[model samples]
Target: MRSDTLDERSAVKLLLWLLLFVLCWPLALLALLLWPVVWLLSLPFRLIGISVEAVFALLRAVLFLPARLLGHKDA
Candidate 1:
């Protein structure tokens, strides 16, 4: 079900890009060409974001450990 939503979103994005291509081929071509370089440049930032998220999760779990031990349920 989630995959279907993602596919639909991809389809919509593609359609929007096609419309851009039809309106201004040069800009669309430039975007298509630069997208890979942009994604590659952003990869490290994405990794950092994931690492930060994991750290926050660990902190949350550690903080909640005493409550959990006392038979408190997570809300």
Candidate 2:
């Protein structure tokens, strides 16, 4: 009885592992194939995000210029 339980558990584990591999392989392959394309497509959005970040940074610098010139260094 003990041996049978152990064998069953191992078989179930193997089956689950196999199922996971089979299910995931196609997705992995698809991602691998499309990663560059997806990245290319998202380049514009990434550029926009960077531009917005830069704009905000410049705005902050301009807004704080007076305080900085007055020697009010933020601790």
Candidate 3:
């Protein structure tokens, strides 16, 4: 389930990047060139986002423990 969500997210990002690239190749090329630097600059925020996601996932699992133990399948 988590893998599916990750795959979907990656696909969406790729599609959007492709759309931008098609619309303006020069700008896209510049973005491609700058991606590594931008990503490095944003690394801290990305880490925070991942941490928050993990916390929420853990909270959800705790909240759903009873239903899971009773064999109530998630829809």
Candidate 4:
């Protein structure tokens, strides 16, 4: 016997995807910002475009630097 509504399954899938996205988001942001994407994207920041995802992007910049520097220059 199986029991699960389509809506309930969709909700569970959404939650799983959100968790996966969050776990993988730093890597995504790192790729975006380390490349030309941030410059292209951030241009709007000074003007009239800001978003929650942008906030996450900013946080990724801070988090990535220290580990990156340490890797480059060993203490």
- The TM-score, computed over Cα atoms with residue i paired to residue i, of candidate 3 is 0.53
Clashing pairs in 4: none
Q: Which residue segments of model 4 deviate by more than 4 Å?
A: 1-4, 26-75
Q: Rank the candidates by TM-score, best first.
A: 1, 2, 3, 4
**What is the clash count for each candidate, in the order shown?**
0, 0, 0, 0
Tens digits of per-residue lDDT for model 3, 1-75:
699999999999999889999999899889889999998999999999999999999999999999999999989
Give the higher-lDDT candidate: 3 or 4.
3
Cα lDDT for residue 50, model 4? 59
| Stretch of 10 with least lDDT, candidate 3 | 24-33
The weakest ten consecutive residues by lDDT in model 1 span 66-75
Task: Please report, in order, the local distance difference test score of every candidate based on alpha carbons.
Answer: 0.98, 0.87, 0.95, 0.72
What TM-score against the true fold does each predicted structure earn? Answer: 0.93, 0.66, 0.53, 0.29
**Candidate 2's C-alpha lDDT?**
0.87
Local error of candidate 3 at 3, Å? Answer: 16
lDDT of 4 at 40: 79
lDDT for 12 in candidate 2 is 100
Candidate 2 per-residue lDDT over residues 1-75, each given as its tens digit: 599999999999778666755889776667667879999999999999999999999999999999999999897
lDDT of 4 by residue, 9-57 (tens): 8899778666756889876556545668667777877665457678889
The model with the greater TM-score, 2 or 4, is 2
